[model samples]
Target: MVEIKIALVGQPNVGKSHLINSISGATLHVGNFSGVTVEKKEVEFERDGYRLKLIDLPGTYSLHPYTPEERVTKEFLLNGEYDLILNVVDSNQLQKNLTFSWQIADLNKPMVIAFNMYDEYSKRGGEIDTEKFFKLTNIRAQNVSAKENFGLEELFKKVIKTYQEQNKPRIYYSEIIEEEIENVREKIKDCRFDKRFVAIRLLEDDEDIYKIVHEKPWFVELLPQLNESKQIIKNEYDEDDLKEIFFEERLALSKGIISQVAKIAKRETLSEKIDKILIHPVLGLPIFLFVMWLLFQATFNLGAAPMDYIASVFDSISNFVGKFLPDGILKDAIINGVIPAIGAVVMFLPNILILFLGINLMEQTGYMARAAYVMDGILKRFGLQGRAFIPLVSGFGCSVPAYMAARTLKNPKDRLITMLIIGFMSCGARLPIYVLLVSAFFAPEVQGNVMFAIYIGGALVGLIVAKILRIVLFKGEPEPFVMELPKYRFPKIKALLFDLWIKTKTYLKKAGVFIALASLAVWFLSSFPRENIVKEYSLKIAHVKSEVKKEELKEEMRKKILENSYIARIGKIMEPITKPLDLSWREDVALLSGLAAKETVVSTMAVLYGGNSSNSKKLIEIIRNSLPFTAAVAMIIVVMFYSPCVAAMSTFYAEVPQWVWRIFYTIYPNVFAYFAALLAVSLIKLFS
Candidate 1:
């Protein structure tokens, strides 16, 4: 079979990733692009005797990149290896989407257009004459709905046909621009790219393209003519910015071609109708909060349903293993260390999944954009644009991806400020700690409300910190926020399940491996150096006559062993700092282990408090009885504001190269967390 490599390209919200997911019999590989945190998705599948490999490029608006993700797309198109370009367009927004389509046409590559979301368009009485479009631009087009999975096979057929024919875009621009392109094209000699593409990019003053052709043998001669061509275009268009001129040129071409090839439905969309109330200036923020409150309520209540059953199952496993393994370090580690610790974290999986599902539903249904729109006004008051809201909200899921998502912010200062405060967003990994404490301290009816309060409170404080940072460190007015809200559509079951499956897999893997290993380490530290304690306890039990008193002495012996264990020593060193918060050594250890991952805080507690039994149900009771109400609130406060896990921290370090900012990012959150915890403890004491 002949092999063809296709680069899948599109503007944002045009269903690019969905299209990839819809491909039948495709094998996918996901990884970060070289030296960048932006995700790269590639798929390979065979169709009709041809092997097709598709590299899904990041969604971008134009060749002139405005964001880091956009630059990644542009650089790949200019330099990455690919045999054909498959540009997906939102059929409902042809005017806007086609502007970027025309820009890609200038690359002069073998191209095919997949008018994605065609089902939505067709339902609304829209039509696109692909034959006319092909005749107009010499690039084949297909109307495909990646979600509905219609017209996809035909789209790929066109893709393969375009590759077979070596077809390239025959699009032309305004006469004046064409004349300039011709002039610059003639001067270009033995260049790697199509001369027309080079000429156009030069006219647009593309810095990346300039770097490429600056060292050419004909550069000295081409320089003056290139300048003259730019001047001619500027004079003819009556615009000083040649880039603007080129943008308008493509935009005009988009309008001209779209008029002939498309019949756009002029009726108001359902999205607009929904946005009327959902994004109302006066009511939007409250509605958003209510929605979040419901989500957390469901996350806590619904997720709690399976906890006892999951706990029972794990308890059975631990008991079975205990019966089989002889009493020693191995058995204690397996029973107390690995089983219960993993069980404690795994018990919270349902909560994490419910939370993820809620967020995914908002995103897939296109309400996420409206959320940003609603949040933009409040964010601006806090020295952040609405765009910063996306990453900050993403920080609720996980900080690693949230930091990566900050790439969408074009301003370096905005990106930095947003990332710095993301830690305060209370990611899902931290949810278990909150749920555990909230369940232990608060009444059942109020637990969900407390969970919601935790999230909203963190976000509010983060915004306040953002405003403070703007005044003291990076002072500037926030950039204007402009976003296109996608048409509302029902989320496909397959896609939603795929997302949930990935989340479940990731959470399980972390629990099985990372948490288990951390628990083992905790177990070793808390279980060892027990010879002296065990001997003393044996003598004391031997001297006691009553069996009940003997058991009491045994329990005392266990606590004494834990007090002097290696991990306890470490926690003691930090106790001076936490003493004001009314936190004990065990709570201190749990918080410190959380620096590795928030989930481990719960796992560490299970290992330390559950002692001999290792049952989550018992662990919770022990915690409620062991810790004071003030201490519980202080623990929650610290977890909310403290530095994120090591993975998140390292990701921040990688994304930010400046050591000064990195150091500040690392140190400030912990210091802030300590003070916050102390204040919470003091206030509770004063009020009570």
Candidate 2:
């Protein structure tokens, strides 16, 4: 049972990540640190005879008790049971850094202040009396550069010392704050927390924190009185408002501390002065578009060659096995099912990794916050705050984690709306659909561009739908905004790999299982003998006369397919029901059965028609060449806007409660997808 944990805490964009990378000599993940998508990262290293575990917490300006991230930071320091907390701070911004140090100070956890960016501090003419910092705070503080890998030996030594220290001092708030703390302490004698931290949260009116107070036996009598006192105090000061009060105080305090400890010679920093072109509306949108265009370009085009090569490799393997093995069910299983299933998943890896690298690039450079800032006005009309841009961007990596990112939004309604639209953002999971669709529907002109357009198409439609839902469903003014825009910096290479690893893990976890199982299921369905209607008639037609007549009959077999297969029988049962969808039995069967996992149609086509190779393309050409254009539209629209597969449905239900209004979750968008595709198909025919 030998184990130890250390925590890293800092204001946003200090060298917290830099320090971790230097200390562990391992890649440390860097992202906007907040929400449940947020968590402390732990990496273990053997440094000088002791196993060192470093946990990186979410960034915050202060723990003066507001915002989910601040709460998460505070709770982890107290709950994560770390032996030491590395209070990472900007050497150039000493005062604002102190607020986090002071807050962790209250937790009384053993900690070492790894004063980061000493070079930045010195260049800015900042001089820190590290000894004075310790005298005021009673915690060990050292100036070190996470960027240069300087002072890590001393940093580790202090870390080891903090771990071994038996007499670590417990700190508290001013007597005024402590008196109320004592009352909460006596009441929470039965509850848990660093008695002092709970008191501060109670003072600041944390809704969840106060609820915990009322549950304590001794506090039940005092809860009402305590709440009354808080209200009385709230009336006296604008300071205790529910939003950003702690943040504002931290900013003010940090600015004050910066002047005393850090110096700036008034030379303009690189990014702070870049507002003229980058943030200007005409120029800004175009630049943002260009940047993202490059991102999607790199993700698709750069990855496509690799993607095609991988697809080709899987195709070759399946064919090689089929040619070598005897004609039997086992060969069918190996060639048709197993290979395609693995291919379905393997093709996505390149795109997922590249897109994750792009998003991580944005997050690390602090462009993410800027993107949100620039888009806020436009995003507001859709029932989102400026910050919703972060989650939407994250969806390109994976939607489940993107959904988790929604918790960062303060408004619950907006968070739910973000989650709902996120799945439509064209994740790497959707890329296989694009690969199949573009290859089938059009020539290879601008293949990456076409795939990129499809991604934008889904995002555009998702946003429009979200705006409509917002207007008709949850109409209200969105909350005001105050987002931290950390100064842009070079994205660390290690952080990029760490991000790639995280997304790769998520992609496989969510989509891999279904693709694998669906491959086998589809092969099983394909291996069975054709059923009563189509099989009977296909057999009946076997004895036909002329070569010309046989060719004509073969062409007509698509009709026999409708009359006779097991899939056909299932479709006919629901045909009268789906006619508004302009769906023929072929489309209907594919739609109904494939609803559980949308990719099933792709696998099913390969199995039902014959080999999944370019052979799958011939099946599509046959359908398109015969089935009315409207039918093709119905198929595309149905899959695009339909109820997401079972996984998305389960997530929606789990995240959202079952209010009567929840019927829209089950019905509205689905019927909309059905008819939209149907109408588009009809319009195409009518125009033709």
Candidate 3:
């Protein structure tokens, strides 16, 4: 079989990933490309004796590279290795997506255009003349619903024909551009590049293109001539500005082709008149809120049973080990310390998996784009675009995944803005805190609304933080909100699950390693009081213990041993500092140390308080009842305002260059926590 290299290249979020996923019979990550941290993916498969290796490039609307993702795409297309280029264009906004198709043709490559999102056109009572699209661009156009995996037979057939059969070159630039290109060609003595591609890029004032011409041997020889011609073009109008002139010209061409050959009936739109109500600001926002609330209810509350089941499984294993193992320090460590930590994370798995499943479903159905569009007006003031909501809403499921989701954006500043704010959104890790606090503090009548308040509080905090950061640290205006609202379809459950499993399995692996080590360390500190009791007759125990019963002596020895342990010593040292936060030395040590990972707070409390504080509420109760009311409440507020783990900090450090800035980021949260607690206590005093 002749191996054919077919590249799927287009602007981001045009459903390129889904098109690849559909053709490969594999669920390639079809979410935001930046979110997935994917620069490119090459997959090999065969269809009808034609072996194909499909390369998925990062989405770019224009080849004038602004960000790393767009730059990477331009470089890949210039490589000229692919036998045929499959241009994935979103059909609803063909005007924009097709512009890149014209640019691709400028490269003089054999290409077949895969009209993605064709269903959007069909549903909206719009007609597209594929022949007209082909004729105008000098490339073949085929329809496809990438989300539904339709038109693969025609797509692959075109791919096979384009690769194996003789194909004509598709280079149709304006006569003016062609004339400039021919004049520029004369100056070159010998050049290895496809002259047309180089000439076009050079005329467009691509700095990278200029650098290449200046660096290469032949271009170096003919540099002055190319520059002179470029200067002339620059004086009249830049070549990068050529697309607009061409765009208007093509629209007129398209209108002629469309008017004659295509007709769209005004019969009821396939999607119905529901959009009239659905898109209305007053009704739409409420409807959207209801749908979002339902999704959360389904993913969280409905999935609680499975989450509880997973918890029980891990919990029982710990209990079984406690029963089966010899009654010793090691046994206790295995059961209460390591196992409980692992169980705490595993319990959330069902909820986490289900959450992403719904997100994946939203993404596949194309409602996500619509949601972004609707959110745009509100989000603009908050330093967010419609796209920003995708990661933020998804953060409710889990922040780590949500952080990864921010990568879908191609703008660097926007990506950073999204990242900084997303952490403030209430993550699932913080859900247990809400459930515990809301249940304890609020009446049952107000619990649901109280829970909603805390969630909205996080979102508001996150967006404000993003907005502030954008103005002070990150330097850039938010790009205009421009994205296609793709046609909706029923999601494939199997595909959704496959994607969700990839995400959940990664979290499980993290829980097993990081949580395991943290838990073991907590066990060591907690078990020190027990470990120090090795000597009986070796010490002066012969005096008092000689008169005491064996069991009583052993008990007394254990009590005395705990008082001298290193953890106790450390607690004493940290006592003063923790006092303001309403922490005893023991709680302080746990709080100070557990800043490495929030999950450690519970494990440390389990050992320190000598109570099985498996849940956040139980732990909070132990802390509250241990100290005075004000001090006990301080711990909760502190944790709420504290910085994320060291790992998360390192990620921030790498992302944001200023270490002092990161320090500011860290110190501010802890300070906020302290004062927020103080404020809460003072407020309670006034209310009472």
- TM-scores for candidates 1 onward, in order: 0.82, 0.76, 0.77
lDDT of each: 0.83, 0.65, 0.65
List the candidate numbers ranked by TM-score, top first: 1, 3, 2
Between candidates 1 and 3, the lDDT winner: 1
Q: Give the runs in model 2 whose Cα sits over 4 Å from its true position.
A: 25-40, 61-71, 167-192, 207-209, 220-268, 323-326, 385-419, 422-461, 471-480, 526-566, 590-640, 643-669, 677-688
Tens digits of per-residue lDDT for model 3, 549-591: 6545654554444445655677789788666655677667566
Give the CA lDDT, 0 to 100, for residue 678 in model 1: 86
Q: Once model 1 is optimally superposed onto the true structure by TM-score, how far is the C-alpha of residue 383 displaced, in angstroms? A: 3.2
Q: Put down candidate 2 lDDT per residue, 215-257, tens digits, no spaces.
A: 6677766676566655554554455673354444445555654
For candidate 3, the TM-score is 0.77
Best by TM-score: 1
lDDT of 3 at 108: 67
Query: For model 3, which pairs clash?
Result: 11-59, 11-60, 12-59, 34-407, 35-407, 35-408
Best by lDDT: 1
lDDT of 1: 0.83
